[model samples]
Target: MKKQLGNNYYNIISEDLDGEIYDLLLTDVNAALFDYSDHHKSNKLPLKSKFKQFLINRLFVGFYLLNKLKKRYTGEMIILSNAYIPLNVPNSVTLLPPWIFSPKKKSFANWKIILIINQLKFILKERSIKLLLSENFKFLVDKFELELGNLFVKFKLSAVVVPNDMAFFEKLALRVAKKKDIPSFVCLHGLPARYNDIDDNRADYLIVWGKGIKELYIDAGVKEDKILTFKHPVYSSFSALELQSNLSNVLVLSRATCGIPCESSQLILTDRSTTLHYTELVKENLKKLGVNKATLRLHPSENEDFYLKNLPDDFFTIDRSSKDDALNQCSLVIGPTSTMVLDAIKMGKNYILFDPVFNGLTLEGMPLVSPFTGESFIKLSNSLEEMKYNINNPNDNISYHELNNFLSIDSNDEEKFLGIMNKNK
Candidate 1:
């Protein structure tokens, strides 16, 4: 496909077809697969009938109505609420939903007519993308452009901050901000899983947690100047606590059964049988380490019932406390390529990457990157023998230098955030 379309492939999907928007909505195409364009032929979405599309197009009416009542944000810096977890932006900055931007218009008829015309133009534009993109994409583009474009015209937004650039409304907001010359920032919430051109700096500035993440982006062709590195508050304010003396309680950071459709080429990476098999193995191994009372800290998306139904009675208990509290309870934490590894280490607990190598790759489909991989303070165990060796010899860990490499806890993160907010001023 790359050879057939050449550079036009990029122009068509990104600009002409608006691939990112469709990728976020439909989950059929992953726009982040720009470097791996050959995957397109295999992942093409089946086309829907024009009648079904017309029904889907009506969803825009609700989207427009939702924004109609939302009062226009009078503040300079607007942070999308979803990004608030990682980026604790100051209270002075007005936080709003990514979709609610356009203010109430006088007449709905005028907007309806515009919507109809845009849908017609979209359906007639490119035949190649007809199967990949549905009328849902056209209406989504119309809804966001109409709303965000209007919001920009009504108020001079100083800057826009979002959790990521891949989501439908978030990416569109950044684009609108760029067109209006407003500074845009992507405050990454967690360690990035994929590093492709489409996943690079979509905003004017990419605010990351540490140098390691910045390097990943840089290695993927993003310029150094485009990224701004800062300490995450979670690490900056984290004072080292004494390791739990009684090593009775244990925590297993179990992964979600399904991958996020928007982020993956395939959704079901590891099946229930595979996940349950690993859970039983973890339980048996814990017993060997003289630990019996262990709890399962499942991914936020997973249900407790799935594990309860499959696993043997009295295998592992469920952890339902807050993340900080949960870490405080467990002296040792075990997981496979999880972001929670940092949390465990920050709380002065021992963390092991219990990665059972499946065909030379971790459970997340790729090998762990720096800080998590290579020589680090954290222990990594790929096999049952390696797991036993690392678990038995708790002192095999390195120093704090690697943690700093992943997330520097020395910087004034709040100050840097304020500077970014006032950059355009």
Candidate 2:
């Protein structure tokens, strides 16, 4: 049977260390709201307004095409106006008919129609300017915050547990929780891109993956007491997987970008363009080592179609399978500074840390200095040849004890999480 927190606010999803029921006001970054509205579906907009909407959409598409053209030939467009043009209308406005703006059904009339049309014109103009300035998303952030605040009030939520406090919505939710005198907690899902990303003001409590992360937060100015070390729930199942000795099938994890560095002196950071470059290097090295079978696991944020089109088909198989399945099948896992490396460790797979940008450089302000310094289990490879050698000579140097220092593999993660929630309550 399901448990209840109060009348209708939240429900008791799980139990604590003392077998006590804990209420969770579950929430998420509502991504579905950002998806395009179904144009074919019937809506409250009048027939005339619908036609105007169609025209607006067409105009938006035309402007987008023009913008693409402008990007291609910036110098040649001397005759045309260089004013910014948005690629598309905001999903929030386009998803619904303008008639929906009417607070009362009877209030919808000519004035409302005029107002809606004017609003659309204004939005189009503003969006164009925002696009030009690369500030399109900044405008919507306020709307997201307002919506989140309203939801919290409507549900009479007691507390909020989010994955990352650094996210715009999560931070907003945390602020709302603070305003309401309710506790807010952020579970560290992955490593922060930079030290500055960790904001002490964002959450009341932080449930970290392990001691390593706890140390990172403390160093970033987050109070030591506010942070709690808990084993990552995802790693718990894979912790039982024994490390393979004879490494054969290799899995190369691809990242979308090497996040901005904390220090100015950190080697010139590379972008997504380096993805193919790194993958090709890995492919060449694998081929040289006589390891024909290898899979390239694209990051979740990466475009699968783009990689498939660009990457050599014969060199490596593009793995779109679940991470657990991929980890299970592969004997060796290789990647840069990614949370998946921790996952690979939990799965008892040998992983090689490869990052050309951070080579021979260390940032004192960052949690991951060189990726090589933190844990001895991770084999740091400077070049393709080095990586190939490491793979061929499969080292059994990294033990579970070393892995434990980074991640709490054997701990009851649920209990630890519950303890944090209970303590805050």
Candidate 3:
């Protein structure tokens, strides 16, 4: 049987812990655990090296921040730093420091000892799980559980809202809030890319951008009642499509090159080599279509300096402005399956989902769903030839009215979000 790491990890912990701890705490850890096991084709990193990473990545600054900022906010709604709650809700206090900054502690010696003991127990009981418990992973579990539990008590927060349940402190906050009888929610910040039980929602309610995402989650096994659709606050303000005279400059959205380990699944989605290869293909194909120059808009997470130095060719100009500004300048947009496609269409710009087939399948290695899948509504290109075809035929794409069901253009999102949040509060 394929190991359902999240379920398995939870079952084992619930059997031993004997507490009111909700299952959400372990969700993020197991998600990363599954990805980690699939990533390391070779030997595991040494214990010393693992500890160093744990300190650098999780503890050093994080520990200090947690203690320093514990008294900073005492409100009804506690927002985790990574939550990205776009709306300006009342009685909300956002933690400034990220979860990577560890809570202040005299020494990690006791936690390290507890981790070793747990590792030995895992080795004897379940060898498969033992492989998942690296020094860093174990430290994260113990450290966050204790620190976040304390933070919840300190704030006396009645409601918790987060962007996702997949991040360590985010899931931990949900779990901790549940134990304290405080309602928790996930206010989706962007278009969801994956739909599966592995990416299950831990929050009581998942506040989505539209019915499109809500339906996708229901199909993926999430309960319908647990989902509440709210139009994106930003997308609601989308300007009416301005008629353009000609297809001037084309804008290409370039996402960061991330490995399988960085994601929640074992799927071979993107790699450094494949990403660079795809870029080369885009530049070459655009040249074939008589387009000498196009703007390459990098993902927000990407560093401009790094991409400038590493990009295959200087044939393209880098886009540094906001998404709205960039889309306004460009007459035509081409890129992979992303939320940016929605933005491009909202601005009256014709967009082509450039999902070129790499090895008999799309670069994602699987078929995507809805906004990315519905070729009848949106233009999708599986090959370079198709990309050229879609660009030439700009009229063959989803209309402005057709996009309403996905993201409503009405200004009632603020009211909807407030209604749901008030009920929970």
Candidate 4:
């Protein structure tokens, strides 16, 4: 579709799509949304006492609601609760109200009946609360789309750019863009990993970080023309950092408890326990290799208090610094399957893959499929003993040239992204 605004400009809409390329767009709209709290910090509590933790989570929710009410009544919040327009934004861009909830819209009785039936399916399940909230949020997002459609018509939006197509709002925005006859693209936020039953049919195009992700999407049945390769705007800045000489510290990146889907509930519990268990085992192996100076970097969604209280007191120090700093300081990095590994590769740092869930398992039964080809550059350790050997005898086989074949780590990220945006215009 051609530019409807009579200029080569785009309207970027997302909650977390902020950065250089997004900043380049003169017209942008953002939704102020809160992240869903991970209330079940089960890793910190005993298996039998998790029910009590759930009750504590309920109390936390009550307090959170009260805080929201205070923000609403006091006019301290913006977007949903309070009304305010940002002065820093350019006049061309239009920021919409927060799409959290619609108090004016009444709940449909038929929708409530459907939600109740869905809740009944998970009545006795452990993640029932998550299911209930997700269902209700989807209903609200549908209403939010109606409001957005009107805004798109009034503003004469040319195109829509989103961070990803995973969330309810992102998908809804894509639908609105389609109905209005505008191009919609979802930019790559992180390294794309293979998962079962993922739907990638929401957006008109996918903006990926490199050729590696492009190939992965193609393998997942996405059209080749719909996938575009562009260097990550943020990480491209790290290409200038010089590798330090004293790269001896080991950094262990921890994954979230419910990061992946399992075949059954038994597998879910086993996956969580085994991940935590193997992480501790990695620490012990590092100590045996005389690498006492190490750090454990928790996922943003992970509860730090849970790990600090539950894990061994003196096993490894927790590093809350930025990921780039941690990767630069650490000589060797290890993790199960994360985008951090790609960051390390881009920075010329050595890394080892230690996914206990799928390292030894067959491809058919693996919990998660790796995106990389697992070439000799990226070493794998099946057991603690193997991990120790890899740590002690480090290899310098992986080079930037080899990684470039997979990831397009070029410096002209801004130019490349704009080229794609203006292609249709």
Candidate 5:
């Protein structure tokens, strides 16, 4: 069963641990995820590891850890992921990272530094059987280089390909896989964007959505023989159509732009959540200027007390987690970066992505960064008059041109992915 990887993080989470305490905490978490109603008592993990002896390692932790452990224990060995994973073992592998990715440069830098060191160690230590998991289902470009490096490495047929990522993450994975020299494949789930870069550096084989993705890869760079458009392992078929949308009708998406859930890195992004606060202020200013009746969707876990105490009664909040209600109701979606935007599109709703793109540290517990532009709505003034006018024409004020042909996949994603993987296999 899938589970959460709490306690492992010691920053904004908690620092309660000893030397071997990491495993202990993990056991506790796993037990909770597995529904610990009865079975208790465990000094060490019931299952042991191939190398670490303790069965768990910091390298593979979080939601990802559960899947790896499931594989080792021969317990259900099912794909436990936020996205699709490999159906088989050794030949198929997951490609997403075990930890949350930060958009901030400092996190990227630390990751780069640590990765470079790891690469150096891999070279020096000769631990070449490297398998990279799928994508983060959100940030497609976040770890492109790392995946590319993994694909480039020479090993025993390299790592197996698993269905990784859901939406954009899968798209990014496909692009990177396109770069690989080996026979590569990804099972279908949501049809992510087919990056032109992917076709240029196409994998030997691919599991794709349907004729559309197949045609896309062929256009991008994939040889016809390398591409396989699978009948979805999940859905039957799908179609895409654009919805007429407006801006004044606000799309309230979940955003954790507050400062409380801080990123672990102290170097930069220490105060990255200032944008959320700033956004709040900007909204207030807009309201004072006279614009009212915008949707304010709070992140699922966000504390509304501060905003409740400050903002006027005009503001209205809704459940961002409820995918159906928001898409079917709101006009234009707005937030830092969230899956809800994509979810909105899938539901035939228009959206405007708001991304501040922090330079330093990006906090944990925050949502993924939106892939859209920050200045898209700059022309709209904070004045009530401007907001009201903009609200009256949400589509006109914001850039809707960004949501073009690529992201409009209604349901044919799974087929596209599996087609590629099955062909490669």
Candidate 6:
């Protein structure tokens, strides 16, 4: 079937034949397999149709293979996206079906399917064009354990693609990939170990934080061989920036404790989705307390208008130029758990970890599924206040050696991981 589709003598397909062809394409796994030159003249689509086609295309699961086949030669990659294009893209990208994506409907994860496909469609144009999927194929339809047969089918995919680990796509893709024998990659963004996704079968490739994260994965069940690590792409240049020294006295982040060896001087208010309007809440609460002397640093994209309208003029807002700048002026971080808490530790700053459960974990009996505990985690959340009082008092029990061991990273791991991703590298 693949050979027949690759054959040049085959009649050039037309949109008039789209429905019938789509039916035939569905019968064979290779039906939509296409070459760059064979598909003639492009067509524009209405925004609504474009979005519908996008949803259908994601379900197909054949996109990665088709995109990879195109890499046999350097050509243009065409996709459907409203986002800005990446520079140095190997192939050209364009919209095929013009449709606006809607997320309001819930057809048993139809919305989630559309979002992942749209993202891949967007990324494909910049990277190597691989394969394409039919509009309705899914790797794991439903279940935690993989259906061995479908898992094997998915293993053949050139890449096990997923948008974000939190997207539920991560758990399913990794499970399928594990059964089929392939690498599964996950991108992490500041969600704590709250999700039990640390299973050994979680994923093979992880885009996570520094060395601490790698150990976390190891502890979770991922074998060393199945893991790949890299700094978040957003933080690749973090080490290169000059550290701003003259930080302000007011901090916007949540995890901070005063009077510690690394105590913070800045007044703090961390952002949570529950308190996007925290400034207003803070103002009201402060007014009740009769206190009015604090500066506010924003949590990136909080809705300022809601709070501004309610607050008085004396309440100043800290407009951090960027995430990096926010880090500089931050006095102390306050949160239950965060990768950033470790970052603060790395920077030798003061912070307070306010875990919802202290002196214990959410998992009472199962350590594998339990939250952080023991000396390593206690340092961030439970010990900060105690350490503050004992400033200048040395304790041989403070296992700095163990802490360094846990935090240290094998720098050579990056080259090793890239070697795996790019066979020729």
lDDT, candidate 5, at 323: 57
Segments of candidate 1 deviating more than 4 angstroms: 1-81, 85-92, 98-132, 237-241, 245-247, 261-272, 384-398, 409-423
lDDT of 3 at 287: 85
lDDT of 4 by residue, 45-80 (tens): 545567765664344334334434542212111111
Segments of candidate 2 deviating more than 4 angstroms: 1-156, 197-201, 236-242, 245-247, 258-270, 358-376, 383-389, 392-397, 409-425
lDDT of 2 by residue, 1-425 (tens): 12322313122222321111111111111111111222112213456767977776555434334433432212111110011111121111111112122222111113323343444344433423222222333334344445445544543444565665433334555665676666666655565545432343367776666666666666766787677665544542234345553447788887554232222212233444567777776677667767777788887655555576677676778897898999889888877677786677677677777655444432222334423543454566757666766655545434455556665532554465455334433
Task: Provide the clashing-pair count of each candidate structure.
Answer: 0, 0, 8, 1, 40, 36
lDDT of each: 0.59, 0.49, 0.59, 0.50, 0.39, 0.37
Off by over 4 Å in 6: 1-163, 168-182, 195-200, 207-211, 229-248, 254-292, 296-321, 330-336, 342-349, 352-374, 377-404, 410-419, 422-425
Model 1 worst lDDT run, 10 consecutive residues = 33-42
lDDT of 3 at 334: 78
lDDT at 300, model 3: 60
lDDT of 4 at 75: 16
Residue range 81-161, candidate 6, lDDT tens digits: 222221122333332111232332111122344454455444333322122232323232332223322423422232343
Clashing pairs in 3: 61-101, 62-101, 62-102, 62-103, 63-101, 63-102, 63-103, 63-104
TM-score per candidate, in order? 0.70, 0.57, 0.68, 0.60, 0.38, 0.42
**Cand. 4 Cα-lDDT:** 0.50
Relative to the true structure, candidate 1 reaches a TM of 0.70
The deviation in Å at residue 381 for candidate 1 is 2.6
RMSD in angstroms between candidate 5 and the native structure over all alpha carbons: 15.5
Candidate 6 matches the true fold with a TM-score of 0.42
TM-score preference between candidates 1 and 5, better one: 1
Q: How accurate is candidate 6 locally (lDDT)?
A: 0.37
